[model samples]
Each structure stands twice: as C-alpha cells, then as structure tokens.
Target: MSRATVLACLVSSSVLALTVAAASPAQAAGVDYVALGDSYSSGVGAPGQSGLCLRSNYSYAAQWATRNSPATFQFLACSGAETDDVLDSQVPAMKSGADLVSITIGGNDAGFAPTVLTCLTSSDATCTAKVNEGKAYVANTLPGKLNATYTAIRNKAPGAKVVVLSYPNIFDTSAALCEMSMTKRKAINSGAQTLDDMIKARATAFGFTFADVRGNFTGHGVCAARPYLNGLTIIPPQNSYHPNANGYTLGYLPALTSAVS
Candidate 1:
C-alpha cells in the first residue's frame, strides 16, 4: 500500500507504535519518522504536492528527511488540516516503533486564514470582531482539543519523540499594502502570538519539544528586506500567506534541525 493510504486509512486505531520497537538500531539507517500537520508543515507555498497527502518534498519535514536520511520517512501533512483532523485521522501515522514525529497545527482551529481574508474583504471593525471570535476559540476551545490530540499521539506512539512546531509571525508591522489595513495586520499578528503561545504550552506540557520559528522569520515576514511569506497573489491563490521556499529552507529547516539534536 502507498504510504499515504497506510497513514490515513489502512492503519487501525488499535495499533500502537507498530514498527518502532523492532527497529534495528545497529544499522546505519535511523528510526522511522513521520510528519503530520497543516499547510505550514505541508509546504503549501512551496512547489506543488507530489502525493495525495498534500505534501511537498521541499517541505521542512522532507528536507529534514533528506538531511538526516532516516531509515524510513512519511510526509503525511495535509493542507487545511485542523487539530481535530489530526486527532481523528492523522494519528494512524503515529504507528508503533516510530522514532520521531513533528507537526504544525492549531492555526486552522483559530480560523487564522479566514480571519485574514475577512479583514481584506470587509471593514477593520468587522474583521476584528471575526478575529476576536477566532482568538477566543484558540484560548478556550483549542487547549482541550490540543491536549487530547497530543495525548493521543503520545499514547499511539509511545516510543517516538514528538516535536510540535510553531508558526511564524507572517506579517511585518512596517509594511504598507493596498490589500488590507495596518490594524488588521497587527491584529493578525496578535492572533499569531496567542496561537503560538498556546501551542507551545500544550506541547511542552505533553513532553514534546516545541520548535519556535518566530526568530527565523523576524525580519523576513510579509514585509521585510525580503519576505519569507507570500503576499496576496492572483496567480496561485492557494499558496497565499504561506511561507515560500526560502522560508522553509532557511527559516523552518534550521530551527527544526537545531531542536531535534
């Protein structure tokens, strides 16, 4: 069966970390590793996906696989996935005997992208109202959902070292744009802080290493000398607001690598 099928369909919930226990450590190859998350982890702004999982080989997880040369690697991150999606379905990939796991979720739960769009399409006050709803969701609803998902991952893959990754502050306060107002940009960044902090706290609470990439995207946000994130574009609407190749390579990859070893 294809890797995506195995991760999303074939594996039963009853199966714990299946392959992780018998892994031959004496071999030169490393342990079985799996990547799971939303658009950020799926490389939505990179080149198109090569599989049904919405995973691009240029993603940070794929890059990490190339650099580390793990015994086996599965890039199962799908774009638009929320915390519930991972908890309900993606947990199948956290098979027994798996060695390492990394994920970037919670933004979708916070209605992040939609809030940004609401700001663009409507009034600043209207946008803030919607964004506030999302923020409240993150604060109140997301924690319990995140904890359940994190705990499921730990239970499903007891042997694996889970690494929960953070999203960057996609906006640059200094930038001026016709697409939206500065107030919305700042509001979105404020929401980003809330999401990141919550994810960080929940991740560390579950004993997973939370990799923060805010530092990497510091000056390279949507407005900088050179932006790591994409601005509104008509050419490819799907990749909008996500990290481009440079962001994945220079920003996320370095941070993820350092966090692992």
Candidate 2:
C-alpha cells in the first residue's frame, strides 16, 4: 500500500477505537464493589439462591455487578444478618480499595420478622401492638446499632461510596381486595417507614448516601395487583415479606444504580 493511504487507514482505526471506548458503560472504570447487609440484600424471596445466606444472582448487588462488570464483587450479605453479624462477618471481607459498597440492614435487628408474622396471624389490635414494639426499638435503640455498623464499614472500605438502602413498606393499604386487615397493613407499613427514616438519618450522619426503595415500590407492595414483595409463603417461610425477583430487578436495582451513578 502507498504510505499516504496506510496513514489515513491507521488514523481512522484509532478514532473508531477511541469512540468505542468512550461509549462503554461507566462501570468499565474497574470498580471493586462489595454487597453487605441482610436478607433483602441477599435476595431471600428471589430465585437463584443457595446455602444458608440465600445469595441470588437476581439480587440487586449481583445484577449491578453483572451489568457494570466491576473489577471485583463480594456478595457477603446473609438472610438473617443483623448489625452485629455485619460487624463480625460481612465487613471483615471488605478491603480498603473498594470503590463501592451497598447494604440493607436494620430490619432483622428491629425484629420486623416476628412483628410481621404476628400481624399476619393475629388480630388487628395484636398486630398494632407488635408493630408499636418494633417502632419503639427503632426509635430508641436501632440508631446506636446502625452507627456501629456504618462506622465499621467506613473504616474497612474508606474510599468506597457506601449506599445504605432502605426497606419498602410491606403492604398496600389502598388495595380494594386484600386478605390482610387494613389496620394491620397500615401498622406494619408505618413501622417500616419509621425504620427507613431512622436509617436515612444515620446514613446521612455518616456522610453516606441513603437509597430509599420505598418510592420505587410505592404501588407495588404485598397487596398490589403486581406486588414486588412477597406476602407470605409456608414452604420457604424466610421469603415472607421480602422482595420478589421483580422487586430486586425493578425496585432495588435502579435505586442502587442511581445512588452510585
């Protein structure tokens, strides 16, 4: 080939390569992302799960990692983890060079599991009492526990942009035809809101970003026509009140992506 023709071809090739590289997804920057927290983060209700932790490829964390193609990803969140569990087990796996970290904790710690169970199987008054108990714990005690967990995360992954995710209100009180009493549903949702508010405050105090999934999940609670969260299931009882696969894909995935991006 003539020298002039060869030089022109080389220039075009270089320009094409640069354009393709520039158009790549933001995650191509080699992010080291860690997913830490409890059942919600572990994808309990969603499918593609295994072992005691119930880690699912469908979980928001896994989906995010898959789409972004991060340099490294550790899905350490477990089904029944509390703040203490995070401090003792999950946080230990996190390293200093991590570029991103996401968590969904405090629900199990506030005893939402048993509270919801009570609401599902008991009278409206009884459900209200149990929900009140959870609210009391959230108001008076969960802050300290959350603070400890958040602090440990900051220390472990100093450079990571931590996104603290909040839980969705479990029920749709507005649903016209539903089995759960409106009173019970409202009480349970109120408890979740209280917990979320507290979590947002603590996350902000730590200078971490708080991703509220409630807005994404507003019309998609348990009683909705297309519910993202599971109502109750006897076979795998742990899945109860947790987000379904759609919830992770639609409700949570976007929330985390928005927070990090």
Candidate 3:
C-alpha cells in the first residue's frame, strides 16, 4: 500500500480503538450505598431541597454516588446528628443489601459551631482547655459509639464495605483570617486533627476504612482560597467554617472511589 494510504488506515484504526474503549462497560458494577451522618453529609449549604428532615442533593455523599452511575444510593444522613443519633436513626434506615456505607459524625457531639464560637470569644487558656476537653470527650466516647454503630451496621448489612469519614479543618491558623487569634486557631486545628486521628485509628482497629478528608483539606480550612472554604462568612450571616461544595468534591470523591473500588 502507498505510505499515505497506510498512514490514513492507521489513523482510522486508532479512532476505532478509542471508540471501542469508550463504549466498554465500567470497571465495576453499581453499588447499593448507604450514607449516614450530619449536616455535612446532608449538604446544608449547596443549592438543593432544604427541608427539615430530608435535605437532598449537593451533599458530598449524594455527589459521590451520582458520579458512580448505575449505583443505587440511600442517604440517611441528617443535620445535627450526634453519635447516638447515628446509632438510633441511621442504623434503622439502612437496608440489608447495601454494598457500600459512608458516615460523617461526631460534630454535634462536640457542639461544633458553639464550641468554635466559645473558643473564638474566650481567652487563650480557656479556649485551649475547652478544646482539650472536647478532644478528650471524643477520644473517650467515639470508639464505643462507632463500635456499636458498626456492629449494628454489620448485623443489618453484612456485605457492605463501611467507610467512616473524618472531619476537615474548619479553623485556619494563618493570620490572614481575623476570626480567631493564630494561637486559638492553631489549637482548634490541632484538636480537629486529633479527632481525625482517633477516628482513623478506631476505624482501622475495627477493620473498617477511614476516609481522611481532614488531611485532604490542608491549607484549605475556613480561610482557604476560593472554592475550598467560603471565607469566614461561609454560613451566610455567620462566619464561614465548613467545607464548601468544591471542597467536598475535592476531598470526598477520591475517597469514595477508593472505598468502592
């Protein structure tokens, strides 16, 4: 064949190969997912249905589920859910055939926003002490709580791969954000990290997976660059302290992929 004709044939072959690859089925089948947690899991800020009990869409869990098409998802997460609440409410809502489960809890147990406000308003020593106390509470309480919750989950859905999510850094220590002093901000950040570590350790000990969104959110706490966290006023009329949609997308999707894969 002529060199020009040969080149054209090769090009056509390459295009056909690409098309075939694209048309192939995905690596894995759809999962029966159950999401359990608090407001973060409920997608409080992102645009969606904002009902009292069922705040749907824009949530990290929902977003993650949506990205993995053909997957059937059941989101049982709620706002203001404490650890006990997960045991009580979420466990009952879970189905027997769940293939994957993800949970983000413990914030309300620590009274997250109120704690932050208290630290922001208190003296350094007082704030440090309070944060320390909160950390101790989590360390002491979470293991048992998580164990019970996981046990119930296993009983209800034996085949599911359970994943526990760690909280992100909501307080930035850098001097750029004026909401709290650098020292206090550092304390809060350190406390949050400690909580995450505890959660990871417990999850590992219990043979469950830990999704470290905390580490993924480095330098992108409450005062991070645009899209990670919404400045100090992210809550709208309140200071910005939670992960925005972009932050959730960045920190959550990879973890979800790993959990299911």
Query: lDDT order of candidates, best first?
Result: 2, 1, 3
Can you list the residue pairs that collide in candidate 3? 232-239, 232-240, 233-240, 234-240
TM-score of 3: 0.82
Question: Which segments of candidate 3 are over 4 A away from where they belong?
Answer: 1-29, 54-56, 231-240
- In model 2, the runs with Cα more than 4 Å from the true position are 1-28
Scanning candidate 1 in windows of ten residues, the lowest lDDT window is 10-19
Per-residue lDDT of model 3, residues 154-254, tens digit only: 78888878888888877655547566777788888888887788778877886888887766667667655543554444223221355566666676555
Per-residue lDDT of candidate 1, residues 1-261 (tens digit):
433332222111101111211223343176688888988999877786655555777788888787667888877788888888898878875566678899999988788766766776678899878878988998899999899889888888898989998999878888675356788877888889988999999999888999999998998888676888877644445567788888888778877777776
Tally clashing residue pairs in candidate 2: 0
* Candidate 2 structure, TM-score to reference: 0.89
How accurate locally, in lDDT, is each candidate? 0.77, 0.83, 0.67
Q: Indicate whether candidate 1 or candidate 3 has the larger lDDT.
A: 1
Q: Which of 2 and 3 is the better model by lDDT?
A: 2
Residue 239 miss distance in model 2 (angstroms): 1.6
Clashes of 1: 11
Candidate 1: TM-score? 0.86
* Residue 140 local lDDT, model 2: 96
